[model samples]
Target chain A: MRPSKLVPLAAATLVAALAAFPLSVARADDAGDHADARPAAHAVHDLWVTVQQLAGGDSAAQHPARPAPQAVPAGGPTVNLSDLSHPPDIDAKLHAIARLPAGAVRLTVPNGQARLGDYSIGSEQTSTGDLLVLHGNADVFGTLRGNLVAYDGDVTVHSGGVVTGDVLAIGGLVHDQGEVDGEVRTLSAATPARTAAPPLSAGALVARNAAGVVGVVLTLLALGFGLVLFGRPSLEIVSDTVSHSFARAFVTGLIGQILLLPTFGMLVVGLVLSVAGILLLPFAVAVYALLVVVGVVGGALAVAYAMGETYTRRRLARGAMGSPNGYRYLVVGLAGPVAIWLAWALFGWVPIAGDLIRGAAILVTWLIATAGFGAALLSRAGARESFAGRIIPPEALTDEYLWATPQFGVPAVRRPGKR
Target chain B: MSGSRRARGGRRGGRRGAVALLLLLPAAATLHAQTMMDASASRQLHGESRLDARIDYAAGTLRVAPADAATLYRLQLRYDRDRYLPLARYSAADGRVALGVETTGGPGLRVSSREHLAQEATVALSSRVDLALDITLGATEGELELGGLRLRSLSLRNGASRTSIRFSRPNGARCSRASFSTGAAELEVTGLGNSRCAEVALDGGVGRVTLDFSGDAAGDTRARLDMTLGELVLRVPRGMGLRLTSDRLLASLETAGLTRRGGAFVSPGYERAMHHLDVSLSSTLGGVSVEWIR
Candidate 1:
């Protein structure tokens, strides 16, 4: 958030203060004029500041600024939310949606996941970093991640390139030539003699979030179904096989996806047949559910398998997971997300990955689900002996993979001589 | 069974073959005889005979393993400080070996066991009755406790055997080598203080090998492996200086976190490590993984 934007916001605070306590507003106005009104070097989430002001009312206006403002707590913020778009433009809509106060504020986006159709949207990386959005007029500052879509304001993309999704920051500052993928549009707004552009909204954020959570749950549900059907380690191993074997998973998943279109098409056609063959109509629906249940079951098995291997090696070796009963899948598959979500809820309330933690978890789950589904299709075809059943320990790999480095200096002998 | 009815031109082997046929009840017994012959004498085997020894050695060059067992037995040579020819017709015995290998490491001699173990001990050796040769090596290079020594250049060919090799080191070090073959009988060379072998190979068949080379004494270490079938694994120090190169046939090599010096520069990770190793590893069948740790 820039200093210029803060000036009006500061004045807006004064106006609201004046309306409430008249006497304190007078005193603040006088003090405001006397003091050079230097901008606060550090900015907080704009929405948090807004909610603080709204809740605090007039007395807070005269008081010194909060050392650290806060965003909405876990239960979610209390907003005077309107069912319809209030003020109608992107800027006002964003303001209305976020409801930040007139001054410097901090806005931390929820990293929660959502699911839309077959796609899992939102962060699944259970990290601790939050996407903190500082307040400003046209151009915004602070960390931006995930889908930063539809901002009519000319925002400067920073050096820290956005990893995924679209970038649409219009009017004032596109100074930072950061990466952008999706559509970006710009329009001039007339009224204010300031560099204001038409405001753009992000229904996708809500849609994406909702879609992510749903996707994750559905995927998990599908996995659970498969687990129930195929039995343990076998199911889990297959699911993970797809995930770890990205190429195989993708190819197999594509086949699955391709086959699904026709299955659904057949279902649609089956509905027409059901009208005539009413007795067999029930069988059709049962078959559809059966296919879905079977698919999810298979997917879960694959996920479980991959998760198990990954867990046994990286975690059990270091004593991170300490169960002797061997319920590795139950522990890692189920517990990883919950642990991350709780951490974010507890510690994420501060800074860092708190807000973004949930999002990361969602992303991870989404990937897992995709792999699970692919695995279901693969196993159904009984390709168990298909040149892919080899278990090569990571250390033996010859290619430079994603997280591989000569650990010569990595401190492998942490406790070798202790015993 | 060695036997040959003395026909017209039959020579020394004639009587030897005749004796072999009579002792056919237990072939192993005939192969392992209760007699002593000079390393220079060409003593024909009347029956199966085996030579089990009790020895104490310094670091020298004598490679005894299963991969080359068949080849060595074919050479049947004399035993001692002479031309070390290999062959199947070697002396045999079933007895206990009592010998100790002196420690051969650097100054620290930091015996990691809080202290040192019983520096000397005795172990029994046999070929027909005993299933496998279990060898144990320790941290510091110690003297060769060769209680069971028979073949001049012995090679072990086992169908399926347990060669449980154990090693101890003051420095908590572990190193091993394997070539690209499976079902190659396992041979554990224990008491690392005084042992020397440039290369170790695993040819074919099913086998489990355990090696403990926990010392920096060896000048330059190199392991060559050629596998056509079955599983092979080598666990060593993660930080140990190594040069790995691979020619993949069917098996996928995974070297996730091994510390090595020279080789086709593989981006430090599992895939590259597996690919760049100079092992003749092909997976026409089976799988293999090599782990490094110190």
Candidate 2:
């Protein structure tokens, strides 16, 4: 291979290797996150009672014929030991038990036994069901016919120790020197239970949706006021175009939306192929996206203006007392779409009715936005008036013609042929 | 430069930096938005012998290594609990274990970004038992180290994933075969000679693949490679004899150090070498490159 090509190839290989290395060993922080969360501490009592019994020591003499596993004291907690899965639930239960006083820390393991402090079972001894050990390590040298769960302690299955079921050590590790027929799980820290909150009530849902609708309307109103303040002429032209050529604008907007992605992709590919244009690729993409957003949003606002103006004009014609102004027109125009959304928000939690209203609102909003976008395109972002029905005849501008024409309201029809 | 020109340049640079930061802020928010759950599970080795292990991972980074002889299998997983649940099930009756992550619902279309599904799982398998291992991956980056394991057979299937399988040390048992099937994935297998497999098969569709046979070998082996598109690179041990037979359509081969013998390429001293690697390759619209390594 050529040296020049080799340099780039080697660099590429290095980059790839560097990128893969992190993905392979990037969980250092995760370990810290889990390790820092310590489970609640359980009071320690009757420590290593099982070990003493196993050795036939003083504690064993007190229980001559294997006395029934009793609580350390009265009114203690009881834990179910049938299933060892779902660590978070078990952690919560254990934490609740841990909070009890030392004398009241007795535990009831359903279908099994619960022991506090260090526990053990010697070889030749066989136990049944599950065993829960808290605040101490579990040393097993015998046969356990069921699961073994150790909380805040280690589990050592010594030689000849046989467990017929799963073993779990929470907040500790498992030292396996013996045989286990089931799964062994060691949790360094008991993760908190999943916080998937319950569903909200219908009233709460309605209130939330209403808040969202109000926020959206407020934002749109601010944008419309700014447009009226700075570029009323452009807004007026676009509004007029939407009123005069609504269907044409809608068709153009639909086509533009369909071709948006393909056009962007083509622009990108063309730039890459033309190496010099690659430098301008990012700027070009940003500009293109900005233009699209401006057209769509500005057009929607223009449509609202047109709607408000028409309504105000009709009200004025019917002798309703109201100021005819750009701000008033925008406000009136925006109220139409906002009212649809308001209806949706109010009834959106009504099952089928809510969904139907929401769908109608979305459809109406999309129609208006699309027509507005098309009008913006046809009027060249309000720079052109060809689609706004603003063209005038040259004869109308003549001096004699201007003198005869009415300056306000409707142009008085030429007075029958007097002109 | 004039003072005004310098000032304008500095302002432009500052504006660009602000824009870049603004663009990156959302990406940072997205990375921190998802919650990852960490869980680990293992099983102690018992008197039982043979085992069958299956791993199915939908997305993320996966690492598999040989575990201590005392452990049957151990899995440490960090996953997105919202979409997936960790799996650790073992059946002592058939000596079959299934370990990995399963979707919360059934396998639906995954529309999230790779970062959102950034789950990680590390699996360690026992080396004492005769093992049949199978792995299936989707949109994953996997590093499987299968050396020092008593592996009997191996099968890997991946979709749009990058997976590298390495046999750093020789297998404890003779492997019957190793097979790989990929869909638009970049897969690399290193130290294949250490696998001690009699037969190796690879089926690829539209992705770059590298198979490196640069480890100590015990006996002769055969490989059948079929690729539809993209590139394939083969790294051969210098001491091992190589025989390559290819069926190609619009694909190019660079047999730099091998002799073209009739319809196939043969390494030097192929007939006298201690072990031979017989390869039959079929490819379309892809290039195959060969590199001899020590």
Candidate 3:
């Protein structure tokens, strides 16, 4: 058969086998119960005694209580007399013996074979039928027409031994040296004796978590640096909004988040009602995702910048030596948030405290994001807008000219040395 | 009769009437608590050409039909205010419109022991646009008439609802795939041949299902039906060549006017028919019957 066809057949067989496993186990349990309820039968006991005697180098004549053969009925089926104690059908008898529970039977085949640690079939001898061994080793040096099977014991066929049928070892091993006309199969014994590996050390686990946190922090820093370089203006506006009107921006952002779903719903409704609207849905979804991302990054930057501004202002008032430049602002803004996040990640391993700190960080980050989004909206997407809704008069630009506006085409002449 | 006897009888009647009045108060209060809610929305098609639509509903009677050509889709809803109403969203961009309706209460809302809310939606698909449709239902009765529409793909899912979907006319475009899955629902799809899809799949749990393949076949089609503990009935047109294979455990199969060949059942003259259909059924704990129709 082709491999493809064989695969499904093998799978089906496996499924059937698994389905029957529980039933077979239950049957084995019942048989065990029955065995416990009764003493060993005399015939079986005598068979074991004969095996033991043979194993001890006793001659067959020493055991006179060997099982007697039963007479065959006239004109009945022909019975093999070589082993009168066994059934006429040698194959059937061997199968039945094999089906018995482990250790239930100790078999010495040929009725009088020499019981070395291993039984051997001589090279000069040719067996007409299959050889069956139970809980014992079998060594074959001669030819046989039928299979050689061992249960819970190994089977070895040395050089010059030829078998026309299969060689099988159940819960055992096979060592084949001679030519076999059929397949050789062995089933390994069940395994439950292996030990499991020990758990990792506490230090190793902590190191792993720390590595994960470092990786995340590095990635975030790279992204923050990119935002600072390319999106400076928008970032500045959001940070300014957070510094000036943090509470109002936060409330607006919260409201916007709450209404986001409803607005998307409305958009979908419009799309369904208008076939032409379908073309715009994808763009709208993309824009929405972009907005959220920008809001979050801007909010984080704003928080960082606000902190930097406060610290710089305090230091400058105290006559400290530090340049307050764009680069300093960017570095402080980026590092502040990253440090907070890293702290959150580290404390996350501290049982209850870790959970509380992580939750607080998440809440604070969300608020910052909303506040930044509100700020972005208030700034009209980074466009400059006058609070008074009017341009300042040129006269107002000159000192001591607040009351008198500067006239066009003429420079304002300050009063000569009013000091 | 004496005057005192008459007076005592009147008093006893009055006491019984007062007791009856008190018993009816709670029922009256419940009736007063129910409120009627109405909502409707519509939008016009401008430049978009394709639509992706999803309708999610729970615990209501829903009806869907093709709309007249003036708009892309229109929805009309009437429900009890005490219960959740469906929220609708429509967005169009990049030549694709996504329209969806979900219950405001979402899946967490517990269905109250009251009358089922009534909700009806009439959607008109523009012949100019191709569509992908998805519907999810929870314990809601649904009727869908989806025919004469340009469809790309369609999917329907339901839980403990009786839903019937029909295609009264052939689809304008060839559909890629159509599928339905339900839990303990009596689902019937008529004119499946009109769906003009290369593949159709149905999965049902503990409910009766009828799939009628009676519409004109746009091309050769394959169908897969899987059920756990439910009866399935299939109707196939006699003129079409059919090959049916069933994998069943603890279940039986009955075929009418079909010959069992190898592991599959085939209709007579299947080899010579112009159009062919392949059906696969996997069912447990129920019977499948296939009947040929002209």
Q: Judging by lDDT against the true structure, name the best candidate.
A: 2
The candidate that wins on DockQ is: 2
In model 1, the fraction of reference contacts reproduced equals: 0.00
lDDT of 1 by residue, A346-404 (tens): 44434556458867866765655566667666666234623245665545544353236
Q: What is the lDDT, from 0 to 100, of the residue A87 in candidate 1?
A: 14
Question: Candidate 2, residues A73-116: lDDT per residue as tens digits?
Answer: 42356777667666555776888775554446777776787766
Q: Give lDDT per model, in order.
A: 0.39, 0.82, 0.64
lDDT of 1 by residue, B1-294 (tens): 334444433765677787887778588754542221111101112233343333332222222222122111211111211111111122234422212233324343322342122122222233222222323222212222322223222123333333343223221112233222224445443422212233445555544444444433243345555554445565544344445566665456666654554653223543433222224344434456665545
TM of each candidate vs. truth? 0.22, 0.53, 0.38
Q: Can you write out model 2's per-residue Cα lDDT over B243-264, one digit (the tens) per residue?
A: 9999998789999789999999
Query: Is candidate 2 or 3 superior in TM-score?
Result: 2
lDDT of 2 at A4: 91
Model 3 earns a TM-score of 0.38
Residue-level lDDT tens digits of model 3 in B205-251: 87899988889779888999898777899989989988999999877
TM-score of chain B alone in model 1: 0.38
Give the poorly placed runs of model 2, Cα more than 4 Å off.
A1-110, A115-126, A133-143, A151-162, A170-172, A177-179, A187-419, B1-35, B106-117
